[model samples]
Target chain A: MTFTINAEISQFQGKLYKLSHESTSTKTPMDVNVFVPPSSNSKIPVLVYLSGLTCTPNNATEKSFLQYFATKYGFAVVFPDTSPRGAKIEGEDDSWDFGTGAGFYVDATTDPWSKNYNMYSYVHDELPKALAKEFLQLDFENISITGHSMGGFGALSGFLKNPGKYRSVSAFAPISNPSTCQWGEKNFTNYLGNNKEDWYKYDPTHLIADYKHENQPKILIHQGSKDGFYYKDHQLQPEIFVKAAEESGYKGGVDLRVAEGYDHSYFFISSFIEDHAKHHAKYLGLIE
Target chain B: MTFTINAEISQFQGKLYKLSHESTSTKTPMDVNVFVPPSSNSKIPVLVYLSGLTCTPNNATEKSFLQYFATKYGFAVVFPDTSPRGAKIEGEDDSWDFGTGAGFYVDATTDPWSKNYNMYSYVHDELPKALAKEFLQLDFENISITGHSMGGFGALSGFLKNPGKYRSVSAFAPISNPSTCQWGEKNFTNYLGNNKEDWYKYDPTHLIADYKHENQPKILIHQGSKDGFYYKDHQLQPEIFVKAAEESGYKGGVDLRVAEGYDHSYFFISSFIEDHAKHHAKYLGLIE
Candidate 1:
C-alpha cells in the first residue's frame, strides 16, 4: 500500500490521521481518515464510518464527535470518502446525489462507471486490509461498520452482502430500502444497467431476505421521525426494510429506532452518536 | 432585537437556532447561534462563545461539542460571529485575517471599518441584551464568556473592561497581548488609527494592569504548546499576560495552562471544552 499521510491532527485522547493512498480496486487515489485512541493493553477495535451524500471524509472527521467516543470506548474509527474523487469522467460532477460525492457503495457493472466506481470493493475489502497493514495495533477481525444517509445505505448493504465479516453494524437515518427510493433508482440504472436483479443484490431490503447466516446478529438502526428524506420525499423507507427483516429467517434481527424531532444532518448524527458508539462497543467487547 | 430564525436544528436534547437579526450595535444584519438545553426549574445560565479569525457562528457551532457540554450542564451557549459580515467596503474581503473575519473584537475608530466593525460593542454589550430578550429562560446575570484565539482576546478584554458584567471568563489560545503580535498590530493600527493609547483599551494584557475590580475571578486559559502562533510567530503572548496579571495584583488569578502536543484548532478546543464549560458552571453555581 503506497499510503501518504496528509496531516495528523490531535482530538480528544487520540490522533486523527488524514491519509490518501493508491487503490488497486478503483485504480485511483483515495482519501481516508483514521483515528486511533490512546493505546491500551489490547489491540484497539476498528469502526469504519461511511459518510452521507455530498460529503467527504473531512465532513464526519471534523463535524461529528466520533473521535471523542472512539477514544472513550478505546477504539479506532476510519472515515472513508463518499466516492472516488477527481475521477475526471465526462459528467461525474453534475448532480449532488448521483456522480460526485455519491458512490452508493456498489461495484458498478455498467460501462464508464465500472472503471472508477468500485467503492464496494474499495470499502468492504481493500481499505480495511490497507489500514490494518499501516496500524499494527488495530484489530481488524473485531471491526464493525456504521454510516449516515447514503453511507448508511452502504453500511447496511456491506454488512448484509458479507455476513460475519463485521462483528456488528449500525446506521443513522440510512436509505434502508433504496431499491424503492428515487435517489437509488437513478444511481442503480446508470451504475448497474437495467438489471433489477443487480439492484436487488445491493438493496438491504431485498438482500435481507436472501442473505443467510447461522447466527444472525442484531442490526441496530436509528431513523429520525422528522427526517424530510424519510417522510416527505420517501428517500428512506426504513419501515419496509424492518418488515422485510421480520419476513426473513433472521427474525427480530433488525432493531429499528424511530427518533423524534431529529433531521438528516450531522446534528442528528452527533446527538445519537453516543448510543451508536456504545452499541458497536458492546459487540466489539470494549464494554460490558 | 429583530431576530429571524434561519434554521433550528436539534442536537443532543436541545435545539440549535441559527439566527440573523438587525443589529443595533454593528448596524448590519448579524448572525449568531444559540443552543438552549432542555428546561428545568432553574433558568439556564448563558455561555457566550467568541470565535477566532476567519470564522462565523457556524464554524464553532457545527464543529465544536459546546452544545453537548451545555446540555450536560443545563446551560445555554451563544455563538456570536467574529465580525459583521457583508460590510462590502473596499478591501474588506481582501485578506483572510485583517478585515473580513478578523474583527479583532474591537470597536473600530478608522474610516471604512468604523461603520461596521463594531464587534467589541456587539459581543460585549448589545448582543447580551438582545439575546436576553429573545431567550427568556436564559439567566443573563449568571452568564460567563469564552473564546478561541481572537475571540479569546475578546473574552479577556470584555471581562476585564466590564468588570462585574460576566460571572467568569476563560480563553483558548487567545492573542493575549494584541498590542505586541503581528495579527493584533495590523488590526489595532488600522482599526484604532495608530493611537497606541486607544489600542491598549482593547489589549487584554494592557487592560489587566489598569482595570480596578472588587474581586478578581480566576480567568482560566489553555494555550497549546505546539501552537505555531505561540511558539514560532509569538502571536499569542500568554506568558506575558500572566506576568502582567501578577504584577497588577491579580496574583494567581490567571490560570495559564500550557497544554502539550495540542494545536490552535477546534481539535484543541474540543479536547478541553469540558473543562472551560465546567469552569463557568462552577461560577454559575451549576456544580459544587
Candidate 2:
C-alpha cells in the first residue's frame, strides 16, 4: 500500500504530490495527484476530483484551478487517474471514448477489462484507504468529491450508491444519463456487458432515483450551454439526472447551473470551480 | 495581415483566440494566442506574455494563470510563440537551448538565424501592431509586458529599449544578467556574431543602468529560492540587476520578490501571478 512519490510541486500556498502505487482494486500500478493546502494545526479536509475520458490526473491538476481555491479555503485535493495505464489489453486503446483513458469508473464484470478495470472500487475504496495510510495530515471523514464529464457521472453515481461516504458531490458537464447516451451505451455495453442491471447501478440518472438511503444526497452540477458534446452529440444529459434527483426526495438539494457560452473544456471547470469549492467548504466544515 | 482564426474557446466569460498569421519580422507563419476578457462598454487593456525557453505559446496559455487574472481584472492577454517554427536551417532543431524553441527573443545578426530569428522585432513591434489592427476592442496604447525565464530577460530588455511603449513591466525568474550567464553567452555568441557589446544591449542588468529614459522604469520580478536553475546554475541574476537598477537612479522602482519552497515550473508563476496582474491592472487603470 506504500505509494511512490513521483514529484512534489509547490502550488498556490500548498504542495501538490504526484504519487504512483500498486492498487488492490485494479490490480495495476495507479498514478494519483494529491494537493495539501498550507494548514498549521488542524487536519485538512479532502476533495476528490475525477477526470473525464482521455485524461489522466494531470489534466485537472494543471488546468482545473481546484488547488487555487483549495488553498484559499483550506483543503486537500486528490486527483485520481481516469483509468489504469499500460493495461495492454486488445482493443483497449482502440477508441478514445471506450477504453484506455475511459474506464468510465465502473468495476467491469466483462472479459479482458475485468482483470484490471476496477476503477469503481479503486477510486472509492482502495485509493482512499491507501491515501489515509500515507497522509496523516488529511481527514478522510470530511471529504467531498467532484469531477467533470464521465467523472461527473462517476461522482453522482458514487454519491448516490454510497450514502454518507462523501460529505457532498458536484460535477462539471457530467454524462448524466449514461445508459441512453452514445458514450454511455458504448461503455456500459462493453464494460458491464449486456446486463442492464449492472448498468443501472452505475448510471447517475438511475442511481439517484433508485437510491435506497433515507437521507437524500445533495449535488452541485454545472452545464456549459455552448458545449458541443452536450448539445450536438448528446453525450452529456445533465437535465435527465437533474430531473431524477428533483423527483427522488432531492427537490432543493441539487444545484444545477448552465453557464452561457462556456464549453466542456477545463476553461469551464476553472471558471466556476470557486463556487463548487465554496459549496464543499461549507459541507466539510471549513467555513461557517 | 489577415490572420487565420485557429480556435476561439470560451473561458471565464471571455474568449481565447488562437490565431495564425505570416509574420513580417520572422518571415514565418507565426502562431499567437490572444485572450479577451468580457467587456461591455470600454475597450480592454492588453498584457503581452513572453514564455520561457523550449516553449510555444501553448505552455503559458495552458499552465500560467495569466488568463484567470486577465479575466478578473478585465484585461486581454497575448501569448506569442517563442520562435519561428519549421525554419529548416542547418542545426536549427539541434539544441533545445539555442535553436527552434529558444530564440532568446533577440534579433539575430548571425548567419542562418539572422534570416528567421527576429523575435525582438516580432514581440516588441510587429505582434502588437498586428493585434491592434485585428482587435478593435483592445486598447493597444494601454498594453503592459511580462514573461518568464528567457522570456523574462526578453520582457525587461523590451521594456527598457522601447521607453513609454509598455505601461508596466514584470518577469518571473528572468535571466536578468544574460551577458554573464551560460545561457546568454551561448545565445549571444551564436546569434550576435560573438560581439560582447551587442550582448550588453539586450542584457537587462546592463540595459537598466544604461537606459536613456528620463522617467525611471518601474519593474516587478518574482524569483523562487528553491529554483535550482536560479540558485545553482546562476542563470537568473535578479540581485545583480537590482543592484544595477538602484545604482542607476531606479532605486525604488524594482520590486524583486523571492518566494520560498517554489520551483522553476509554472506552479511558481501561477502562485504569484495575481500580484503581477494587479500591478499591470493598476497601471492600465482597471483598478484604483
Q: List the residue pairs that clash in candidate 2.
A: none
In Å, candidate 1's interface RMSD is 0.9
- Candidate 2 scores a C-alpha RMSD against the true structure in Å of 1.4
Model 1 residue pairs with clashes? none
How high a TM-score does candidate 2 get? 0.98
| Candidate 2: segments with Cα more than 4 A from true spot | A212-217
Residues B54-103 of candidate 1 have per-residue lDDT tens digits of 99999999887888899888889999999888888888888988888888
Tens-digit per-residue lDDT, A1-288, candidate 1: 368999888778678889999988887899999998986736889999999999989999878898889988898999999889888988999999997899999999988999999999999999999888889899998989999999999999999899889888899999988878899999999899887988999999998998787646688899888899999999988889888888886743888888888899888999989999999999899998
The DockQ leader among the candidates is: 1
Candidate 1: lDDT of A279? 93
TM-score of chain A of each: 0.97, 0.97
For model 1, how big is the CA root-mean-square deviation? Answer: 1.4
